[model samples]
Target: MRISLALLFAVVLQLPAENGYAQRTHVAISMNNVSVEQILNKIEETSDYVFFYNDKTIQKNRIVSVRNKSGKILDILDDIFKGTDITYTVVDKQIILSTNKMQLVQQEGQIQVKGVVKDAGGDPLIGVNVKVKDSTVGTITDINGNFSLQAKKGDVLEVSYVGYATKTVRVQNAQVLNIVLTEDTEVLNEVVVTALGIKKEAKSLSYNVQQVSNDEITRIADANFVNNLNGKVAGVTINSSSAGVGGSSRVVMRGTKSLNGNNNALYVVDGIPMSDMSAASTQPTDSYEGAGQSGDPISGLNPEDIESISVLSGPSAAALYGSAAANGVVMITTKKGREGRTSVSISNNTTFSAPLVLPEFQNTYGQTEVGSYYSWGSKLNTPSSYDPKDFFQTGVNVTNAASLSTGTDKNQTYLSLGTTNANGIIHNNDYERYNVTVRNVAKMLKDKLTLDLSFMLSSVKEQNMTSQGLYYNPLVPLYLFPAGDDFSKVQAYQRYDSERNLLTQYWPYSTSLALQNPYWITEHIKIPNHKNRYMATASAKYDFADWINVTARAKMDRNNERRERMYDAGTNTLFASKYGYYSKSNIENQQIYGELLLNINKYFVDNTLNLTANVGANFENNDYQSDYFGGKLKSVANLFTFGNVDTSEKNLANQYGYHLKKRAIFGSAQIGYKSMAYLDVTARNDWSSTFKGTNTGSFFYPSIGLSGIITDIFRCSTDIMPYMKVRVSYSEVGNSPDVFLAIPTYALVDGV
Candidate 1:
């Protein structure tokens, strides 16, 4: 039957508020005059009477109610369904019941059939679907394709394949029964993970989206996660940097949109999008630096902590996300809680790194001058790499991580921790990072609902000691002096260069403007920058009717960054007067989202279909505050030396900035049939704070996608081949980089 996907979605909207699955029940039954043989035979003809006294089937489908009196038939089954705390409906004697109650049917004779479902090359089909013909009796194969089913010696067993033809065998007394299903051309279809954690045949979906799984994911490492898709995607460019700690990479999809605002893509963890690049809000005026010195912020996240990541690069792919997804979005899925048994996982890894970019400098002649030339006054001079001996260059770095995971059937959790340290080839130039994380998921609503939560914390420290800007130039004329006969008293003239140029002739370790002593700067010239970060999120969902569900979510991310860069008065580096400078900044970011989802399903002829609809709202706010101070003190004190109440000149100032936003509504639908064809559409509107009242209006974006199953259409299954598939996708989203752009500007002048 052809149906509007909206109708199916409306039905799914009835799911409970929280996963609402009932507990299991127990029962035992003894047959009377009607022998077990007759009951089994009658089951085939009866349409209204359903029986469930079996041992190896759906646990919930097991009938706990029993019958002792003669043929009151309907009354007996009805009583069992209600009294045993089980639920089910009897349709024409065929028990349409809940999976919570298990059913078991018994046969007297012993029939053993055991075989492996391996590929043509003899590799086991770990998860192949297997079942008995003409009945609901079925079982999935183990990872090794090894299966064991019991039936009467004379009964015939049946096997069916998803992409292969059916096979039936009459059970004999033999101990082994092996079977194989060929990879047919008529069975190629990509299965995709969709809304509300469901899997659907790709052909039925109408929205424009793409999926990548299995072998493709295992081929990369933690740091290069996004880099692997460089040339494969249609509208994405992944750029790499060669800075400290392997400058994080950037991913730009489509073209840059939005005014002067940031067009960087948004990252969603599991289902949460919360993170901040560890860069400060302010930079030195004459410092010749970017607003943010660090690379992409998302790079700090541990890739091993992720199970799968899908890029919702278009409005159609992220319609449900509203305004936050205006530029684009990446949805991530983490490992989840499982049932039945216990599994343990442990992994240890290490990596080595080297700088990809470096700066060049001229290094010849020792500390000397022209007219006022001074050899190594009191000390002997030697040729070095940074000297006339410029024939050497070197670089090195290291990183490592360790993790463990173990969980029970009811509740599962994952934990990991790691550390990375890098050193630049430059003197005293380097960066280091340490991180830890814990994630947990629980079965709060039995089989219907579940809960997921995660927390992460990390710290980064960096040091850069070089003073070649101005001031501290030893190559200055006044500081120049002649060397001693033995060059033993060079220390006296060290601060006083002999051939020092007054204007700009000097080495990197000259003065602040002329290049100060890097060794002296590293020890006395300090720019101690440190950052601490924390992130968290919590959300819940419940099903109302079989087709309806409601969800509420809240998330937060906060970070503190502080830096103190100053010059100390020491004898070696340069002659310092009284001085000190420092700055501190605090940033806070938060977001909240709420939504409702409805899913509908139907089956007819040779096809099955599904529909989903959802409504939601999102709000985000970001704020930053900074404080700066500088002064001339009595003498050069250590970092902690000068307080706000210090010895001399004072230059204190503060700056504040903020961003607020809101997004209206979004919706999308997908359709599939016979598991071969797919189609989808998505749309959304948003309001941003970066734009002013006159221009801060709403924007709409949408996209469509189509796909086909080549294998299923061609019927290629045979004895020689095993598996193959092909797929492609295209989508579009909006861009609003300068949310705070297009505003009026003003000029100010000091009044006499």
Candidate 2:
């Protein structure tokens, strides 16, 4: 019952202009009950001819059967459309279908044109688009980058490919042509945003800095935008947390630098440093628990409001920022109002996720006993139908956003609103977030003084976001369930208990491993987290001359978070008591930062030598507080209130806080000679409260870098090598000691 499928099509050949087609090409098809569109697609896939027609001209949805084993093209068409009013015409290599017969003959001056496309290195490029200028006639280059088409002598051919510039050339008397495309440098060469929101030319930078555009961040939607930067940059490693959806991501540049201190890159919004209050402190060397990790501060930002992100991957690039940026820096630039036409944008993004790789399991063996968890007994007569994948559901995320931007020459304004709702693969796991942002820029005092102001608010809520943890995780039990057992029996995971007079978990299996009914754990054990964040920023710049100006900026960012864990009655005694367990904590964090800077840009020696420098003073204050209280519920089932704690049993209550203040003065200068050689130097001194018990908690950092443009110095043509530079730098950066390391504090225990 083997039937060979044959491709019945014609080959590419030079034919006379008077002939409508070459010899009748025969094709063999053994399709059953397929649509006409399928047959057309097969023809196109197997032949040199392309079919062109409008949707209205063909009954693409009409179902028909064709059993042709060496039938001519015309004969097959006749049999497929015997009573239909369909007509077809064959142009040189294009087959046109229509209700009315239309004749499209080759022009008198038309001839076959052949060419090969290659890059600047003379290597052939495949999949390049080759088309006639302003015409629908087009074809893609083959494996050898060779293309052929019928065109007139005066017609133009457009050759294009991604990452390369488009090329248009007029066809002359030559029948054979060779086209070469060059890479577009304009898109690759962009201004680099460096430390403290300073702008500099890419060629003048001595250290590495990578910039990611807004489009790249929002192209694929994710609950946490940091996850989108996984594989986009070099020398950077991004590890996503096991904490299901909307979890924090760890970004490390270069490598881990600290042995017992923070190694995370500093996050700077606009020009101010923001605190990462939610980041986890435990590492691999410590007792790791994935469930304890939560979303970081950057996760609350709306991706649409971002203009670009710059990653300073070395210490030389962040020396001016002091000890906070010892590892590196991730600078975020928010979008601003542009003085142009008034516009409104609305967008919605929806995505679904599922596990692509799953572990293999042996289904031939059944458990030794009925209630045993292991499956290593006798061989099953029938293979087990139980699949761990059945316990997992498809994860979904939906995001809706809208924005309005309008402004005149003097003033501009931008406002945006966004909301996201997401569900994880595990049941009862959900995440929700909403964001609102408004920014305005104004020019006053005859355009000499400029002011910028912005405000943002975010609200987030999450429930039961399980990670790779044994406790309260349904996957642990689902994966180790006994094979050949009826999983459906556990679907009704709860039953009425007469003695306790309440609904109790209904599982007949051994509880030595702390295993519970998978369904019961998801429904009864709940963990919810909520966060609200607000931020406001204002900056004013006054220009005394075209080359010199002073700017002052201030920002305040605050966050309040509440987290709760509730265990219901009849839950595992290891994690819950008979009356159930409940715990909750509230945390508040705030940071206020302000800085004043003096910028100077001047040229000497007939504009051949240039100097750009900035001197600034910054002050930052941070305050953190936490309140926690929880205990076993008393005399009640599933009543998770703090007031219901059992007095006889041990209860927990605590309040702790810390305050940190810092002051720093920094200066950076870059000197350029003929825009070909540059020298950069930076110095910063910081005074912090963490240096208590010591003579002085102040330190100074300095860095110097030199870079030379090889191409510009030699005056070489840019075609062979567009850019070339040699750079070297040396820097001294330090990591400040943890707070309260020099002092000790005590807390009360049960009011003792």
Candidate 3:
């Protein structure tokens, strides 16, 4: 008996310590306001263990707060489930979770749910997020705002949309749901994207900034989206050139600041500055002799790629951009991949356009004489059958775009492709464009280091682009055609010239040099423009501490543009030389920018006073080169190649090149008092290569602003007025001269 008792005691003593539980591993965790599922995920990630439990049996939605220093798994679980009626058991490499009162049993059935989301006004809300609460099953509303998901009964459905309040509806055995969301005006008015891609509370900003959402910018399509902003924003004016499709647009904010230089606002995309260069044009003494206006750089951007646009309309709001923002700044923010399940979206749009109004012409009078250009001739009993309306055709534009976004907790990816095909109001004039964009985001080192990389490729081709001059513009002859003339007679504008053995203009008039056969000009004269662009951006951010961080970003944007002008023989003699004229021009522009930023945010006085500061340095370089070959064609009558031009010194070609560099150091600081009042101060110093002398090359700018929330300070009812704030700012900004302005150069005379 004694020996048996001794054997039992020895075996019990030999068992594993901690009641047969093995000492697996220990972990250090500190989490606040986390969920039970998140805690288990962290544990699973840190150890070689898997968690097993019925999702329906576990209360994953319960909030948990825990802190442990090198604690064992069991001890951490105990701390996590201290007051809850839950328990866990570890066997082998799995942790089985069950309620304290009973064992967990997994459910095998799921309900299928379908729903349509709409706004309070009953308008379908596309892209609304519909998710089963606390699960990985989610979907977005399609173009028609309809969604479907597989969720069990009693599972909550969380629906959310931008600028709308979130709502959670419990599934009550209903197969279909029609949910309507209310607008959240406070959230819409509270956030604003500032200069340098910084987001801030609107009420705390010292200067005024206006925001335009993607919905507003994409509500209607235009060849030049910048024209859509006309009359939409205060203190801003937009002017679109008469050049047909893909024309240049001028945007002036506040007022003009430069007397001789460009007054157009600077454009920034995703925190990187973009070139706003426009193609050069010859100013004609009269409207009929100059080259057509070329498309602006901004016109090449796709509106579908934009997420939002913020207009810093005043110097105070654009102080950080230094000399480049003397006329204010237009900051563009693009969409990024979200942290959720994969989603794909596709959209198509078609637009029809026509002339809004046309000039009135006298049709009661015939030409003064048979072939005279004057319209003050004797009255005609039969009005002229010529109508200007017959010269213009209805324009059609079609655009298609698709985007895909997918991401995990630590990585995200986004890809987009779009195409635009459009026809102008004039015959034989059309434009086509293609664009592709890719972006990837990665988080490493426990989310302390973040990396973002993006690339964009775009191409634009314009056929028979209408120019301002009468040489290539069909409008010149279409509008000036004699009222008494039979318009259909000129439809076949080319006739065989027996002497030249070639097709020649069939016009009967010779008075005005600008007037020509419209059909002849449209078919014989060719002006084709092509532009290709590539942009790449890489940015990395490292959070060294909770209150301090640093970011380094670099970007390169390059584009090549080619334009050709060909004039066939027998065209207007004044516009084209003997045999014919052909000109080819190639322009290349490149911009490289790099920035390093230090950001700091700290709290004082028990979080009543919050302060934020940003110190950054930027380096930017721009290079532009243009090569032109222009002369009268030699030998070849219809060839449009540069090699066919006469190579003599009298018909020489010219080239031009310009290079500029800009460096800037900027700093900004903001202070807020209990989210009620705020003060902001910013300073920037720029060194421009365009300025020659040491002192003249550098400029300094500063801005200060103050804002106060009267409603918050006075304890007013928000129901009466959602928000009320007053702000005022003052700034001193400088404008740098145009490229090569400060340098001395001589033009080539006869190819000297």
Candidate 4:
């Protein structure tokens, strides 16, 4: 028949890989209806031809004797593995048995599937279309929706796509799956999670990573989850401390990377590495008015134990993290181990936060005004209901939670416990805080051992209300103080200097006879604070083969602090003690980390290789201590006196510090050459004792990158914009600090 149609058109043309795309081949047959000469004698009873290709595979396994008509069954198994190096791929009616020999092999007894395809309020449903039923096997999913398929024995699976309803799975014995897909309100897609955790397809990322999940930080837990990420990211900026809600918030992710340290970033969690310091958040803007400053140590964490948050802005999106990431990096992912069928979740939502930005102040004058009224004209007292409705504005809140999850297929677990309480709107200027948190995740030795544990406890108490200190302090008596003198009779009559441009005094509150005593400085001042904290991490990973893997990590973070400043013994004028004064402070910090890692993965299927390799070694240690004391006492009977016959002149301070950082050498590499070409290389080295001499020591940082997937090498591969990729990266991190060698040179003094 015309030489069997010219050898099936020379085995349907083929080529692609050295940085392009296509490289497919196929040959599979396991039928209940075999013809075409019993599928060419079943590929000549399993390979090894020779001998005139075994009589042309037994005279072409007859279809009425080698097609007494034409040809099919894939042109007779493409002339039996055509060019003999054996390779394959066919995504409809399954068949992928590649072998060009660049190994990363794993195959075990058919029936397999590992899934992820979300929708119904859980968002994530890409390309969906997986099949098994009615022949023509299938597969499609990637871009975070992940997928892996292979089935046999009682197949019967059919999951359609293109929108809502279509599912029919019955392979019986399941294996790791998670699919939700619901909303197709006429196709609407938007999903992104690039750089490393690879889950692209959010229009194929060009440069932008800003995902904040976990229900938008539990609906902005009363601000301070990094201040609810202020105005949501565009050029990010947030500076706080106008005395509001637990005070202190200043995060600038993409600007001012450093003019003198304090420029921030690098705060990973779960993938471990948290604690970027200059003692994180310095608070101190008058603890939101009344009560010695405090608030902003990760704002006592607990945003439902976060689930995912990425903010790796600059340094080329954190050049594989080096040099403390140079003011950029905040990757955090927590919450796991779940396979379902044992779920218990209880959540509580609460809201009551006052102050959506307000600070205008000047309600038609209250604590006195208009000739400084007490009796107008010259200067004097203040009262008249000290009105303006006593400057009104208030706020309050409370929340609670609990969780539990379970799974099977060789185990899965997640446990959670939580609590929160808050109050603030200024009056007795109240603030009360108490919190407890616990998180656990386990996946037994079957999924290859994994366990993560988290625990937290917190406490806060505050008080503020002793009235009077108004009409904007210029020295007492702002308006009506003569008629029934409110806020303690008026003192030093209205003294006015209005910027003492130094000279004159129409004293209505201030003109310098020092009209002090704003209700005796908020009645007997008092400031108190106390805190304790701990954070941890422990790890172990082992695969040892199948592309190798080994890991070991241990981490710890600790904090303890105490502060008190109280004074009361009469000082209506610089000195008039009934006897009382105080100041005390103590602080401590500790951090430690250890690590070891190695990973490698390889797969090529003919010059469309994709490789990954990583190595690690790390050790870190830090400790700091501080103490201060101040005194003076006589009698309120000595508010717990501290004296050597007290009279004022009490000062004491102590500080201790230590740090040891060590990092061994390691090399990392990633190469791709097909599947849209790419290459990435990395190297690391460090040893610091805070650096000293020859202007710094032990350093080495290397990086290189390039990517180009351009629509899978352009002849356009799609199914709703599959992937795009186009990357360029360069890296060279640095940080050698002796902090300007802690200055103190001029060694010539040795001549003594």
Quality of model 3 by C-alpha lDDT: 0.77
Cα-based lDDT for every prediction = 0.47, 0.78, 0.77, 0.52
TM-score winner, 2 or 4: 2
**TM-score, each model?**
0.62, 0.73, 0.78, 0.31
Q: Across residues 22-96, which tens digit of lDDT does each residue of candidate 4 receive? A: 122223444443344455444434432101121122333333322212223344455554654434433232233
Q: What is the number of backbone collisions in each predicted candidate, taken in the order shown?
A: 105, 1, 0, 26
In TM-score terms, candidate 3 sits at: 0.78
lDDT of 3 by residue, 207-321 (tens): 8788887877777787777888877678998877666766667789877776767788889998888875643431322466534544566677778889888999989999999
User: Is candidate 2 or 4 superior in lDDT?
Assistant: 2
Question: Candidate 4 — which residues are off by over 4 angstroms?
Answer: 1-215, 218-223, 226-244, 247-551, 560-562, 568-579, 589-752
Worst 10 residues of 4 by lDDT: 48-57
For candidate 1, write residues 157-180 as lDDT tens digits: 666545455567776643356776
Pairs in steric clash, model 3 = none
Candidate 2, residues 1-752, lDDT tens digits: the string is: 00011101121132233133523565666566868877776666566656654444578868888887765555566667778877665546555555633222223455456678976645466556788998988776653567767676789998976557889989774335789988665554235579999867677788888888788899988988988988988888887766677777778888888787777788899988888573322121123222443556688899999988999988999998999989899999998776756889899999999878878888899998878898989999999998888888899999899998888778989999999899988887888999999999899985779999999999989888677666676887888888888899898899999999999898888888778888887899888889999999999999875568999999999998888889899998876788898988898989999999999876666446778899999999989898888878788888999877775666477676889888999999999887679999999999988888878679999999999989869987488786688999999998776778768676556768
Sort all candidates by lDDT, best to worst: 2, 3, 4, 1
Overall local distance difference test of candidate 2: 0.78
